[model samples]
Target: MQNEINIPIILASVRKIGDAFLKQYKQNTIPQSMDELLKQLEDIDVLCLTSLKKDLTATFFHMPWHIGDEFDTESQKESTIKGDYWLCDAMDGAIQYLQHIPGWTINLAFIRDGKPLFSVIYDPLATEMFWAKEGAGAYMNGKPLMVSKKTDLGVMLSVFEYGHQDKSTNQLNKEIGMTVTRLLDNFGIVRNYGPHGLQLAYVGAGRIDLFIQEDIDTYNWIAGMLIAKESGAEILNADGIPWQWGSESLLVARKSITEKYLEIKSLK
Candidate 1:
């Protein structure tokens, strides 16, 4: 008797927006993590998202098994792994952990195939929220934003989280290494963190000139992509791809910065 959202309708709109983004850019934005999404349950309405937040948490549990395949090689290593969900052998552990996960860390998104069409990120402590509709653009606290245009690679700042200690898989480490080495050799400045979203927003808002990420999916990229595109920023694959719809390895920066940075790093 809740009489709230119509799941099919809401998801359909998400798909529409996602399709437009694909028509223009040919790819989708990555999504935020589930636990991160769960943490923001209180602000669910504020982000204008669906009741799926609570439902999703429960659904993951009743679904029988967790999908560890969501993560690629970069997130599998013990050193690079931050959440239990990233480990290949930890599917059971992830399901168990998710069962008890706090509602405050939720980060929700709607993606198409491998790209994000719409997204909302709610950060309770910081009390900051971010959301986006592809082609419609990115937003933070209702304010429109853009990415940096600085192209000096040496001057460009970068970030990488939790990949330095273990290369047991080496898949994530290698890709990250290649991307960072290019950034450092060219941009010369780099940093790391344990979480995402906020870091990407900084890049879109021009607070940071450039950001290179090795492990990214639809939920993580969508909102930030809107912010960057509206600001006239651009995103691409580190290997010089034009950012396909399902790409897992993504690089985002100000348009001016991306061109110059890529040239210096020989990325494109």
Candidate 2:
């Protein structure tokens, strides 16, 4: 199935859609109320999804396609049944985009049996296109990506993402707080970026040394996981075990720093 796929063609289609969305994004004004913001978000989602579905279906009609937000509710139930399907987040960092921020991106991944085969993440504002193919390697704007070689925890920059508010629980809140506290105490710098996927890509590009998130939504990070993994970053769960599709938490760090990071995590 991987051999039959043409990543370049798929990337081209996604990039075209991303470019169009970027134009609309720039013209959009900030909503005055929460209700208004949500309404506009819905409209944008429909527009991006419609265009993506139409273009991708024209070329790869046989493969099924699922939107990122719907994956948890729909695909999780059908976990036993999987082949080749396209999973796309038409507008990653939707909040940032609506607010006219620069961190938004378009993310797409081809999954085979719950594992990413190939993926593309387009940062429209930065004009940076990140991609990865299983066993091939990760790249950004045609340049190969590599994780940072820094092994010292005190000098490493880390990132943490908060889970959706609707899914937040007391335990999750405590976990987030403790994690951030730990990062602040040890890491050189810590930040929470707009798009989760882009932060993972940043780790792959060696721009960030660590990325940890609890209660992760699989669809939002799966594409970036492959990119980071292919770029030689270590993908692990909070328990220090190797990461898999259904892990509730994620910790991505450079290969050179994994052991040291894990040791620090163990101290907690």
For 155-262, candidate 1 gives per-residue lDDT tens digits of 667775432233575587766777666666655677764334456666767777766666545334444555565556677865556676555556777666666656
Report the error of model 2 at residue 144, Å: 1.1
- Which residue pairs come into collision in candidate 2? none
Task: List lDDT for all candidates, in order.
Answer: 0.48, 0.82
| Worst 10-residue lDDT window, candidate 2 | 70-79
lDDT of 2 by residue, 185-235 (tens): 888888998688899999999999999887656778888999999999999
Poorest lDDT segment (10 consecutive residues) of candidate 1: 84-93
Off by over 4 Å in 1: 1-105, 112-115, 161-172, 215-219
